[model samples]
Target: MSAAPFTVLIPARLASTRLPGKPLADIAGLPMVVRVARQAAQSAATQVVVAADDARIVQACAAHGVTALLTRTDHASGSDRLAQACDLLALPDEAIVVNVQGDEPLVAPALIDAVAALLRARPEASMGTAAHAIDSWQDFISPHVVKVVLDAQGLAHYFSRAPIPHARDQAEGQAWWQQAPLQRLAPLRHIGLYSYRAGFLRRFPQLAAAPTEQLEQLEQLRALWHGHAIAVHVTQQAPAAGVDTPQDLERVRALLGHG
Candidate 1:
């Protein structure tokens, strides 16, 4: 599907606690951030700009002929950085912007397009994101895998670390998603990709953190708490994970033939 006219914003920071200078970490012959930008460029987005926290990150993008903006280093989150970026670029309130993680070098261009398109099609939604149905019992029950339950209209009801739509009658430690009532209301694993309007993106950080958001440690709940709708697109399969540690970086490198 074709996406509306859109821009991609990639927020990169140098202060990763697990892997310092993470944006500049070498993946193949290019900086990890640059690889992410190149992948986003392949999408329907008219532009792919890095909203970088450090000048070195800005320079790296410039050297690779990618557009980038130097955002505040003290911003609390990626959303905050993106809000500043929207202002820096002078994007209109109605402009759609996709937030692509700088660490997700293997992020799919088609997936990026799908998210932006989803937002454009759902006017009632302030945000758009993707999820994939969970097939494995381990992933279904794992705290590391975020679960999203959708309403009938394909809007997210809630996102959580715990297994949702709980099958009280079913035995524990089994694949609930593959059986009876659970199969009808299958559990979905949320993807990190997001698409937001420039206006909403700018206003997001100002919204008070929700009690549920604080407990789950999920930022998207803030929007839900404030009565903002989030439309979700369910994909058939999950995308590759983002780099958080040395081990994850090595895994991605091997997948990309860089190891």
Candidate 2:
């Protein structure tokens, strides 16, 4: 099969609990959504569009010459927003859509291409995501850092907030520990980036939530529960984290020479 055309969609919700108006938050005098759209444009995607929930986000992207489409505020997840975006853009079911989070202003173009390419290479897969080796022990144990285990074919076997593929031998009584600080483990840190075949993305919202999804608060688990293969592109380097809180915003600003 020939390579399917792809588009990048950044979901921007204004009413973030951690940081309100997060999509429009400024970093180096540019709206965060605009920054993410600009980064996505550098990728192999044919187009980059911001699927925003607010008009301000649309205007913010408009000012930067980024395409922004206002989507329903009631959509529970980014994938849902992107589904609506696919409808608005009239994308065919075979079209590929990469969900690049709006807060990820520093998301790498290569990572975006990697995920899309992974989906393209795996015709059996309905979705594709990226992962990287876990270097820090703190990240390995932190519930905030989502972990993934891949099958021999590079398909995601599972995703969880808890450390997966538990190192039983390295257990410190009840807690797991990496004895050697310098040793980089095989367990992968799941990046939030996702690429989907448009038909599956449109059907994602309808996929019933599984027990694992509710327990882990991870929507991706629903895809696995529904028996859809998610190809995971293991990357050489970890992508930059997205802004989720006030401290994250400040850190991004500092990185952009603003703070």
RMSD for each model, in Å, please? 1.2, 2.6
Per-residue lDDT tens digits for candidate 1, residues 1-259, read 4447999999999998999999999888889999999999999899999999999999998999999999998999999999999999999999999999999999999999999998778999999999998888889889999999999899999999999968898899888668665586888999999999999999999998899999999999999999999999898767889999999999888887795
TM-score of 2: 0.93
- True lDDT of residue 5, candidate 2: 69
Q: Where does candidate 2 have its weakest 10-residue lDDT segment?
A: 173-182
Best by lDDT: 1
lDDT of each structure? Answer: 0.93, 0.89
- Compute the lDDT for candidate 1: 0.93
User: What clash pairs does model 2 have?
Assistant: none
**What is the Å distance of residue 94 in model 1 from its true position?**
0.2
